[model samples]
Target: MRPKIYLYGDSITEESFGDGGWGASLSHHFSRTVDVVLRGYSGYNTRWALKVAERIFPPVESGGVPPLAVTVFFGANDACLPDRYSAFQNVPLHEYKQNLHSIISFFKKRWPEIVILLITPPPIDEDARLRHPYIENPSGLPERTNEAAGAYAQACISVAKECGCPVVDLWIKMQECPDWKQAYLSDGLHLTQAGNRIVFEEVVKKLKEQGISVENLPVDLPLIANIDPQDPLKAFQDY
Candidate 1:
């Protein structure tokens, strides 16, 4: 019997329209036809996900067939948000790390048998990092948001290690081949179609590593790649 798998993340995992999102793309890769539930939200932190899980996942009932897996990808927003002047507030790395630990513990306690996978957020562009007003802060902390990107990834791995769970390092992969203006939207956040495809491929590989078969999937970049959002496409091509 196929096991039920749940994916938890932010915007990158919420591509509802098609296979662009790893959540949707991975659904097609399972060899034994596993059930997948995409539990994704936008602008969420690990602390929020931990609280929300109690409300999102159904309660345990004997013979109800617990989910086989639950993967988590948070911390993008936890890097801190922009202030009134559009300056990055800069979340403390210690607090960010603690939030990760809390989420891991919450899920582990709830589903001890389920395989937990911790995913680190991808990298931030240097240009985007420099643009933030707080980047000019004299304290020298806000400027480290770019550096915190690495800190956040390491924190994910640290939490996973403490909990004995596997982790997927999306940070290095994205850095290896960042598409610059194309990979991210104007906000300097969120994944473009090409970017999401890369993440989906990694998720598939990780699933297989977890002993779940996710092979022979037809992966495609979203239409966001073909037609530039700036210029409108012809009637036949627009859809």
Candidate 2:
């Protein structure tokens, strides 16, 4: 039985233009491996993602919905500081942390054996911060700077550790390849096709390096735990 994988996150994950976004590109790696379900939503945060996770992986609905592994990506929308991005603002760090903890706890409670991976949002445009003026309005006072983006990424790692969740550190990867602006990102935050491909490639490389092929695997496999955080040979983050 092919494993069912579900992705839950923001607009980037929702763009299923077949390999258009990172999640779409990641889907291809599983084309010959397992069944992939895309559940990316636009303008979403941890609170809503928790709801989506509940709907997708309802508790005790055996034989009703097939077993599926889940991966979550947030922070992009959460960074909208001061709760002031046009109609939204940055999610308070405390609130954001609590919301994330809720999502992880709920999933762990529902499916203790399921794989729940967390991915931090990619970098925001530094020199181009002023480009997205939609963030501030006449009444909106600036709350945070773009440099603070990485701080949230760091917080994400901490949250993963707290939940014992597997993490895919896209922030560091983008830093290593700083020219991602020309290579992968079009809107600074969201990834371009090439960028998505880069993310997918790394995901596949990590999965294969762990000896668990997504191809034709059972849902019972702990795809999350199968990945060792203490292992140095495979991931730079782990090392």
Model 1: per-residue Cα lDDT at residue 66:
72
lDDT of 1 by residue, 1-239 (tens): 35678888776565522536666666766534667888888656766676787898876677676777887887666665444222333455677778777777777788878888888877666455445432344442333244557778888888888888888887777777646444643234557667777777777777678876644322232234555567646423623
Residue 133's lDDT in candidate 2:
49
Best by TM-score: 2
Worst 10 residues of 1 by lDDT: 215-224
**TM-score to true structure, per model:** 0.73, 0.76
RMSD of each: 11.0, 10.6
Per-residue lDDT tens digits of candidate 2, residues 1-239?
56566777787677744556656665665665566777788878776676666676655445544434567788777776654443364676677778878888877787666667777777776434444444444443433344556777788888989987777788778778757666766666667787787667665665554344655354334445566677733533433
How accurate locally, in lDDT, is each candidate? 0.66, 0.66
